[model samples]
Target: APFAAPRGMVATWVGHATVLVQAAGLNILTDPIWSDYASPLPPFGPKRAAQPGIKFDDLPKIDLILLSHNHYDHMDLPTLKRLWERDRPKIVTSLGNDTILKAHGIPATALDWGQSVSGAALNGLAPQAVIQCGSYEHCPDYQVHVTRNHHWGSRWGADRNRALWSSFVIETRAGNIFFAGDTGAGDMGWPMQARRYGPIRLALIPIGAFRFWKGQMRSDAHIGPLQAVDVFQRLGASTAIPIHWGTFRLSYEQWDTPPRMLELALRCAGIARKHFAPLRIGQSLPVPTVSAVPIGPKRCDDRAIRALE
Candidate 1:
């Protein structure tokens, strides 16, 4: 794992939707699951196509955990229990997910779509001027806003949407970070909700598990690379890393298709490829603080639109 970025930001793809985000002197984890199978039963469900990029035991000391929803793939009870025992990190998730965690004796803070929680050090304060943080052994201060996303949740088939689904806007001294848990292109306006928090330095967007049928690029439940580029532009993110692909066999597309399509989408949208990097599992990339100018909706020519079809 990369060393924590004390005054900057660094992110490592741990596989699937799991990302080890080192920012604001805190070691934050998103949808961390180290299980071999994303199912209620072992040796069944979606078996991992690749092992965890960072071994469970080798993870840095975690300060915060962002649990997006209750999908088996995103919320593995065994891993959560282990992390709770070892690191005692502050686990934050959408409503009703806390009930699930509570049943397993894991404490977590639950928030609604527009609610937020700040670290103890911040005393529930709003984001302030950026700080020049040096090396520190503990989290300085931060805020996590539970933002809206177009997704539903159900561990079993019957309890869909009992718990809310959401993205998150993490406010830190370094910069704001957006984590789009798992979502589809709903009104394409949710990204702007996160952007309202502040300029996003790094956005972790899902760009796979969208193809439910042959030749299908997107679905009501997930966004493909084309929609993901639109999301990136809408949020005005300085940089983004694609997730939810190449880890588990969840969709019909080839394992390598999402990133390839993302490359194409970036070119079609006239955005630089480096802004939306797709890293190898366990690869770490330093996030640079860049100016985030608001961009309008994408307008690809007829030929460009047909090429994505």
Candidate 2:
């Protein structure tokens, strides 16, 4: 298809942390990691049970790519290479990952969180500064601004906190969308994406890969189903499409547990199924035009968020 504004953005959950977000006449892929195993080695690391919903070859024309962080799941080098080879679409991600991409021959533009970069997919939205509260200076490579998140970001070895990892509040004229890479639900900024970035029409959030390794639940890794709901409400998203679940069993939760738990969370909160519909792998959903659906707000308490314990 010839390039055009995404009449509206449609999110197709390919699996794990990878998602295909088509918006503003642009087919934008977020962390397009289509590899069978999310590891540096082909047979090691985690394996996926379900295949990618949209085969690499069958993808619509990709205009842009968003990478939230550089964890292998969100920044698979092999997948990025394939995308670069196939479409050569412009890629956007956090800094340092550009080195990885360039190493793979994928020319990409990397940005820190809160930084705003716009093109056709953004619906003609312009660049905007982000609300930040961190010790690190925002990298200069991006045309966008960088904001802080309550998560950890480190690609390799001792430099875990050297480079910042964060969520994005993308501001486009058509609407705003928040893409939370892999993050736990402990931070206050989790909800601020909507308040700070404007109205969040769509949220591509992480809803899986939360492991209970070592008995103590890690607050910086990723959030579970209930926490995902908290993120939706916090971000003031009109509607939400759940990702990072059902594709691969990255954590201890049953492969199908995330969705079932998500429904239960919504039900407990008194939210209608329509308010936060979780898409099937590779399935697409439209961005909700209505902000704050009429579905009465559900009773999501901090206790419920803590229930993941």
Candidate 3:
């Protein structure tokens, strides 16, 4: 049976950066890609070790799509076309990305960093229609804020940075939701930008692909477990589920290194492991509305850091 919509918030990790977020009477997807190989050429490039958590056919009527960038791994054209043809969901992406989609006959709204679009525009209905709809909370309107993140974008070799990459903050009556779309710990201040939107009830953070050299815990292009914990604390997120790991091999770390290191990092920071957890693919869970309780900053001991090696 197709999944029914939820009145509150429920999230399902499909794999990689794909997550199905059901909240505020909407079904949202983040950087969705269901291709077996994360590449432009079929049967080439990095192949997925596991299938998508929720089959593409089983996805509910998608109300919105949060496309982070134009990378092949993040932006699979076939999947996007199928989705656009089927549901005609409101697709939101950063600057220059809309052109890429337009060429493929998929319409998307482009926004720069710090810009936002209200739910009225997302519904594809006239403002007057939305006002008269008389649904819950005035048709359960929400806002999508395009926030800045440190990441590059390119489909081929020479067109790097032509499109801006971004993260998003979805504001709703229930609570705000932050999707940290494919970011690195650049100056470590982006999380606070998302925090300013309001209390974040749920956060989707990345904790993988940070290792390239052996024993390298962090990367200029990605955040490992240690930096992820810092991001979670700085953002003051109520609860987070780790993504971008255990689905595809993008880095040199062990298969379980990201989650294991995350557990260790959480312990070192004196936070409960459940606060930032890893979920099995295809798992769905409700997110409780939480007050804004910011975890104060703390440095993990050196011995704990040494154990990560």
Model 1: per-residue lDDT, tens digit, 203-281?
9999999999888979988999999999998898999999999999998998988998898788777777788989999
Q: What TM-score do all the candidates reach, one by one?
A: 0.91, 0.81, 0.93
Candidate 1, residue 246: CA error in Å? 0.4
In model 3, where do residues sit more than 4 Å from their true spots?
A: 1-7, 126-129, 136-140, 292-303
What's model 3's overall lDDT?
A: 0.85
**For model 3, how does the per-residue alpha-carbon lDDT over 95-153 read when each residue is reduced to its tens digit?**
99999999999999999999999888766566777668766435647789999888889
Best by TM-score: 3
Q: Give the poorly placed runs of model 2, Cα more than 4 Å off.
A: 1-6, 120-147, 213-218, 295-309
Q: Residue 62 in model 3: shift from native, Å?
A: 0.4
lDDT of 2 at 65: 76
Reference-based TM-score, model 1: 0.91
Question: Which is superior by TM-score, 1 or 2?
Answer: 1
Error of 1 at 126 (Å): 14
State which candidate, 1 or 2, has the greater lDDT.
Answer: 1
Off by over 4 Å in 1: 121-139, 293-307
The lowest-lDDT stretch of 10 consecutive residues in candidate 1 is: 121-130
Q: Rate the local accuracy (lDDT) of all candidates.
A: 0.88, 0.68, 0.85
